[model samples]
Target: MRTDIELDESLMREAMTLTGLKTATAVVEAALRALVEQSQRHRALDKLAGIGWQGDLGVLRDPRSSDPE
Candidate 1:
């Protein structure tokens, strides 16, 4: 499946430079990777929310026990 879609020159240039990619395919691939990473982070947060984390969830914010790891 191949088709042509117009993209803004500024955006394309920015994406290429930011990703340091030589081809449009590379830029798109990097963008997709970032998207997947972001989605995974969101899913983790959603899972924590679903578990009713409240304030002190697994001592993430608070200090550990007197054992002091």
Candidate 2:
């Protein structure tokens, strides 16, 4: 499929320098891959929920930040 869109020049330059990519398509591909990996990692963490953990307690403040009782 073919598409056209505007993108930041700095990102294009950085992508070329870092990935040796001379086109905007390569940068978009790399960014999409990173986003997918991060999403998968988030899913893995979500799957770990309820395995072992305690409920959150009330908020605690720093001793120095509160007046002494």
Candidate 3:
């Protein structure tokens, strides 16, 4: 967790300014968290996309209709 690596100074400064993060570490951590969340959301959307809609909306919306199952 304490590994040191090189990063673009201008990019880091811009990130700090945009995010209002005072330190490089904070900006990096925030970026990592955002990346992880975005990836997870994309994966979830992909999974949902694969499982297409299977039921009729009219039946679902009708209050008097008996249970189809």
Clash counts for all predictions? 0, 0, 0
The deviation in Å at residue 49 for candidate 3 is: 0.9
Q: For this target, which candidate reaches the highest lDDT against the unseen true structure? A: 3
For 12-44, candidate 2 gives per-residue lDDT tens digits of: 898889998777888898888999999999999
lDDT of 1 by residue, 1-69 (tens): 465878788998999988789988777778879999999999998878856535655566556533565
What's the TM-score of every candidate structure?
0.63, 0.64, 0.73
Best by TM-score: 3
| Local accuracy of candidate 3 as per-residue lDDT tens digits, 1-69 | 998989999999999999999999999999999999999999999888867778999987898787757
RMSD of each: 4.4, 7.9, 4.5
Specify the poorest-scoring 10-residue window by lDDT in model 3: 60-69
Off by over 4 Å in 2: 53-69
Clash pairs for candidate 1 = none
Q: Write down the lDDT that model 2 would get.
A: 0.82
TM-score of 1: 0.63
Better of 1 and 2 by lDDT: 2
